[model samples]
Target: MPGGTDSKSGRIGAITTGTREAGRLPVLFLHGVGSDKSVWMPQLAHFGGDRMAIAADYPGYGDSDFVEGATRADYARAMLGLLDRLEVDRVVVCGLSLGGIIALEMALFAPERIAGLVIANSFARHPEGEAIYDRSVAGARDMGMAALAKARAPMLLGKDPPEGLAEEVIEVMSAIPPEAYVLGAEAVWRADLTQHLHRIACPALVLCGSEDAVTPPQLSDELAAALPSARREDIAGAGHLSNAERAEAFNLSVDAFLSDLDEKP
Candidate 1:
């Protein structure tokens, strides 16, 4: 819980329900800015381990409140705290969009706790066409999310967002506090894990929507190229939220990647 308790050791915010039976290390999920754990509701049935599958609401977003003023570092620390409370020693850290930035930071600071890594619809930098983060922050703060939401929905969705899904997409994003969105945007802007990409030593999977404009395929390619053991996978007919927009294909990519790692020498 990012915005839970000011003290990492203390509980905070609205706790999301359900937990896996004890088995292996957990997959501790971190969501992007302007998003909550519910965004990954689609993955619950698919990715959680026998022991764990956890998604944390960023300090200010979702059920987590921003009692600590909300910083990217705070989110990372809260994750470590959650793992401590769960009595889990390690995790497969997965993140998307701004969440990926947090995963990169987790890898950088606490790689010992990470057994694997998944970076989806994310990048080490906002390359040429990936201007969504910057634009959303600026517009949402100055003019409000209405314009940002309208302009971004198409960029984030596939050519055809399956029936009855477009409105839900807009709602998930529009709920962000303009100010918290601004803060997270600033963190993403300031975060540059490019130099440390080679240091990600775990089994890493870098995925993107084939048509993603927010993070772009090139972004994941660069990450794959940089991480010594990383593999790149692209889900066709999807955009920023590949896991949600192209659930089947996206899960297949991740499953295959993880399965391959299990087979390695």
Candidate 2:
């Protein structure tokens, strides 16, 4: 694991794996809200063997410093800055939940910087987003991060879910600062990339858990239909956090997509 931190770049931190290879675009991962770079541990282990894989923490989460009133675009800028620090000109960006939204923002911000995209358990535009965002913000503010985590963690998984994984997820969520969570919630609610999806010229893989209650399969289905070069896949026995709950299936799907890209002219 090529794990390191960069505090010099204003507290933006990441967990990077794999050695850079010429002719291979690095894979950059962005985690959902309440999660940090560690959320993509499975992805790093699976993809790091053949290509560079990097997972970054959103501002104010994990080791990153708080960015007051940060929006999804702010997060995208942070990623671009991080890439600049690493001297990476192009990357295959993959993001889940809020991370996925940010990934789309990145595509919108600079389509030239992306080689491909993997958006998991996310939506181009959330219809009931205002209510959801308001509820999440108010919940965290009233109940504290830990209490909110305990209540929401169960819903994020499938019927069977995974043993002990809920606790693990809750632990991560519990650590998020209240202010960061509020801003992130607001960002998610305000996101409206529906009309802009066609502008993304890069190939995209839209993935979701078969039983995702939060973002559901329809969201991914919508994304698949909209993005110019997008495909959809659903992970069985998983929920919103498909990569963590059903890592093997998630990795295989993404790896196959990457392989296909490698074979292209």
lDDT of each: 0.72, 0.87
Tens-digit lDDT track of model 1 for 214-260: 67788789878988888788889997888888888877886666565
> TM-score, each model?
0.86, 0.95
Best by TM-score: 2
Cα shift from native, residue 249, model 1 (Å): 1.4
Q: In candidate 2, which residue pairs get closer than 3 Å at backbone N, Cα or C atoms, i.e. clash?
A: none
Clashing pairs in 1: 2-59, 3-59
Which candidate tops lDDT? 2
Counting clashing residue pairs in each candidate, in order, gives 2, 0
The local lDDT score (0 to 100) that residue 23 gets in candidate 1 is 40
Off by over 4 Å in 1: 1-6, 9-23, 48-51, 67-69, 128-134, 260-265
Candidate 1, 64: how far from true, in Å? 0.7
lDDT assessment of candidate 2? 0.87
